[model samples]
Target: MNKILVVDNNPVIRKMLSSALEKEKYQVECAEDGLSAFDCLDRFVPDIIFLDLIMPNINGEQFCQMISGRKGLEHTKIVVISGVAVEAGGECEMKGVHASIAKGPQFVSHVIDIARKFTCDHFHHAGIYQVFGAENLFPREISKELLAANRHLKVVLNNMSEGIVELAVDHRIIFANPAAAQLAGMAQEKLLASDFAQFFSGNDQIRVIDLLKQNKIMAQQITDNDPVMFNHQQVAINFLPVHDRENSTVVVIIKDISKTKIAEERLRETKEYLHSIFNSVQAGIIVIDVETNIIIDANLRALELYGIAKPDMLTHDCRDLLCPRPEERSCPVLQEGKTTHLTTQTVKKRNGQTMHILKTATVCMINNRQYIIESFLDITEQKKLENKLHSLSITDELTGLLNRRGFMMMAKKQLRIADRNPGKLFLLFADVDNLKWVNDTYGHDIGDMLLVKVAKLLASFRRSDIIARLGGDEFAVLLSDSSPTGGEEKISARFESLLYEENEKKDLGFPIEVSFGVVAYDNYKPCEIDELIVKADKLMYSSKKSKKI
Candidate 1:
């Protein structure tokens, strides 16, 4: 049976047309509006469409043009139905409309005759005009104003810069405006004659065909976010479905976005280029938004230094991550109006451990927004080395005791303590009596061993005593809270016995001897450390002379 689609907003006209067509055994579908008619075409491809010129959403003239624009449905016949012939006369004469039916008392017969003529159905009713009150349906004369208005609409479409094309269900172009022709890189006449999909090859053609099917079947609009190459020019395409009661049409809007696409590609490449450079540097770099105090970006080194991932490193507050102290919260570069700063700072890592860093922070403007760029190197190891070197400066390399400089500094501190409290402090100075004689007879190495033995013997004193190798063959000790003059004599005798025992061991292959002097400091009569050292030296030499005797 021939399929007939009746498109009209009026229910009565739809009923009248459907009844007439169905009586002749033709399959009939009814739609109230152009959109509903398009939905109806999803299931039924009608052989003929009974279109009304006046309807909601898409009027009859638009419906006729859309139907004729479809690829496979070009052969489908359209007959316009009009209640007031002159009012819709210009639209009724649209290009795709094959015939016109004037609505009147003879509407039924006029509808039947037109269906019969188009379908060429074998079942024909004799005197169908008289049987259903049929009459000849002829095209009415249109007003000059309506014709001029139609011409104006065509003129506007031709003048638009955006390419406009109407495609059929089969992805074929049925109508294209002048801009569309130019976008396709072909003359308007040739573009209309050629296939639409033929303009794009390979995957682009496949994608466009799939898009058209979706648009037509779904009766919705689809737009491309990325531009596709059309005729060697980048263009953005939009597929909008325009449906008639019988067939589906998709309006494709093409915009030339080649320059925009190029600009976007260049911008993407520039960002990648800058990112590579940012990550390749040796220093850890972090960019912070000065206003928000948020870490806006960090490079690879920065991420590694903080023991954090890039995503977690960003958006962190500077005060929380780098500066934990309230006093250190103020940024020097930002508040002090300094363009740059070089300072040492402690950074807290993700694991809660702190690292010492030599950081250089600079203030800069990016896109008119203030930001701080912080570049730093980890100096925790360097700081440790410096502390070690400082310790070594105040210590004797061989004896592991405080040197002359270290002894003077400690002895002065002790006298200062003695002044605060009444205490008997003793400064003992000793000399290696035979160090030079041993050096002459058994080489300097043995002499050095003898001197070391004396140092060890002296170190045997109480832990509270400060033992120092003042220089070669010379040593000093500061004893705090010692006894009276009798107690000092006993302490000196105890040290002399320790040396006598070392000589019996023959540890250095020779005997060890030393001369010593003890000078007492009265807390009530505060004396300078230099004067104490001089007094001890004189007494030490007198003791050395007695050792020879």
Candidate 2:
């Protein structure tokens, strides 16, 4: 019979528990106080302890802590019976108590059943045959055959990689394989009829009971508070529910998932470390669901850029987030099926401030779910520098207009647009008269100032016009939606008046004279933009010669 120790300050309660356990054929010892219980532990090493709180000398929580810290009493299970709430009992359980029972006047049988269930043996061991007279009945040959069969069965059960155990409906253990025994840190024979709760710590027993009652197969990693001894070694355990068809009994599989648990702990630590790094990163990061296009995760930089306290507020699409104007189609990231990179796209921040951002996106899978990782680098300053470099490359510094190369590029694009539309295109080619005379009479600085003034005067025309400094003392303008008869006359009159006003002011330090030739492409289609430019150039030379004569 298994021995039990019942400790309680209330003499009546102590007597009742002792009598009930004794009736169940268990050797029961009674202790009226925590001090007495501690004294009892030296001589009578009971298998289980029924502990009570609110005792003299030491409180239940303190006693449990002391007992749990002791090495010699490691296998002795302690069940707390207290007047406190279940939560308080759970706290005590965390201190390494095996289970807890509510203090009440009734339910003595239930308590005894709980205590006896942990002590019974449900399996027939090898020594049972000799003790029960089964060794003399069978012939030697039949006995050898039976022994061989039993050995093979035990070998098969022991070799199974998964921990397997069978329990009776009354919550008594019926059988336990070697794996199950190792997981629970008890011999298979000892665990055969033991109470299943003996294998679980206090709070976990409640959860285990709930899972078994529901008959649901649950898979989860659990951390043990009171560690169990397995093969003379302490180990963490993972309990997995196994489906059984025969006898409709519960078959639980246990595994020593200490390594898996360690890996998960490391993963959690790594995740927290990365989260810290992400928040401190300079670049903004946003993680979105590929299918729903919802922002699932965002770093601190992204939240700051969006000016939102939480990620849930931003409801606009990706295009709205990045584009200066509303696009007729979605952004390339959404339109393209694969990862993409975009440069020099204008994005509006939450404050309605517009800036340039260089963005890249990649598709990644996490926990079997697909997500898009979008990274944004602020490029407003970079873009400003790039624009400055481009201007230096393609613009005449003195004239403040497109140089020859820039003019050619703009003219080509304008001609393409003009060919597709029904609008008229006009080209004005002009040359400053007597530039060498101005340079020789006045200083070169004055001549340079005259060129600048001429470029400004041309730019003062309609914004729709494209003005360029073709070369030194030469300028070109491309006007769209203008006619040959009406547009040419209007442009000539405006040019004459502007030149007269400028010469009257003498801002150029000399009489500013310019020769101009205007040509209109009004249904007079040319094969290419360069062809039209050549025609206009020839007409300008003719006008210059005429003016000189």
All candidates' lDDT scores? 0.77, 0.69
Clashing residue pairs in candidate 2 (N, C-alpha, C atoms within 3 angstroms): 118-195, 122-193
TM-score of every candidate: 0.61, 0.51
- What tens-digit string does per-residue lDDT give for candidate 1 at 443-530? 9888877777778888998888888999988899888644545756876888888878888897776667788988888778889988
Top candidate (TM-score): 1
Angstrom error of the Cα, residue 50, model 1: value is 28
List model 2 lDDT by residue over 223-324, tens digit each: 454434444333444544455552334666555656655777799999999999989998888877766666767888888876766545345454445444
In TM-score terms, candidate 2 sits at: 0.51
Residue 225 alpha-carbon offset, candidate 2, angstroms: 6.3
* Residue 324 miss distance in model 1 (angstroms): 5.6
Lowest lDDT sum, 10 consecutive residues, model 2, at: 126-135
lDDT of 2 at 474: 86
Distance from true position, residue 87, model 2, in Å? 47
